[model samples]
Target: SKLICGSYGTLAVIDEVTIKTLPRPETSLSLLFESDDMASAVALIAGIFASPHEPGAAAILPQPVAAAAGIDLAADFVVVIRLEGIALSVDDRAGHLRGMGGTGGTVETVPQALSETLWRRIRDVDLLADHAGDIWKLSCPPASAPQIIAAIEPHFDMAFYADWAGGLLWLAGPSGADFGTALRAALTLHGGGHAQLMCDRGKSKQLIPALQPLPPAQAGLSKRVKAAFDPLGVLNFGRMHDGI
Candidate 1:
């Protein structure tokens, strides 16, 4: 089950599946911290995670991405932290989070309806819907994100935002750039992470891999697992990787 879950249907075919859904929180609130730079915005997110407020979701949206999502904040970057649960608990946490006071930015409380709408757009990557290029999803240690972004910025014409308190980055780069290579290089230089090409609208799709290459030991293990599941190598062959 563990091996088949994220295998992109390269393993066994499932006949049926069941998923358990949780009850939605009774109420939610979001705190928005407007910062002038990525570093400061990320730092504010870090501070929120360190506190006992326990945010349900946290993300950093740069000015362009925010504007694209219809967030009309007059700031360079916005750090959004959401708290959810019973009405009283959510309100309490939001109050504490607001008192924490971000560095070099004004903080605003977003109403519940607007908060839901904003996070939905972020989760769906709707802000980049019109981007006519390659989109990449990256995950690394939260603290290393600023450096990774800095490393990649000079090379590509791109737009990006961070979620999971800056641990996950969603980036859209020009169609023809060697974005996969450049992004992996930046990840290696800063800290090891995973990169996956989510959308491709140009020739680079044939030139670059959609997923990062696995390390030697991990690659061997994956090959062995694949053989166990599909001995004839016929099930979704090469869907995830070149040979296996």
Candidate 2:
């Protein structure tokens, strides 16, 4: 929790980090499950996280995105669950997950190389990096995710995927979408949460704020902390918000 990650150098410039390299698990397996039921798909994933077979990594990608990632599953949604540990333990946990569906769902093993490729896509978290559109990353509770997505769907047509077991949603929409109003309102309704505009390719660079506007109180505290580190405000100044 003390470590800073995923922030694009706006927090602190890490010259080096002494990280503990975990011993490689003797057996690592990636499991892929496909189904039309988004609710059940997410529920199964939730169950996995709450179970003894806690997954090392997990994600949910829609059919189109799954196809893009070369994951072939004959269903509308694909839940990717990865298990890694002792060989026998991994297999036993996987069997438990498979048995969760009985004859109702399709559970399959994903090849190692292919699994790596798909996870990389999820990690990059830039579904529309090249497009002249507004890209947003949202973080909220997993249970409230489907409702949030449901609300955002009618307002702006966007493609999305979930990571961290649906706690984070990477969504993209056309440029000039109402993030300040409609989109932000939807987020507030579900649960007051964080939403950052990753990029706005179509907007003028001079006008667009580097990140979405933070609440006034948080904005002030952010500036104070940044000043403690970079008093001159030299490192990526204005990249997060004005005057910081």
Highest-lDDT candidate:
1
TM-score of 2: 0.84
Best by TM-score: 1
What C-alpha lDDT, on a 0 to 100 scale, does residue 213 get in candidate 1? Answer: 88
TM-score each candidate: 0.95, 0.84
Judged by whole-model lDDT over C-alpha atoms, candidate 1 comes out at 0.86
Least accurate 10 contiguous residues by lDDT in model 1:
98-107
Off by over 4 Å in 2: 1-16, 126-132, 179-181, 204-210
lDDT per residue (tens digit) for residues 105-183 in model 2: 7788875666667677789964445444667778888877777878877776677788888888888776664643555
Task: Give per-candidate clash totals.
Answer: 0, 0
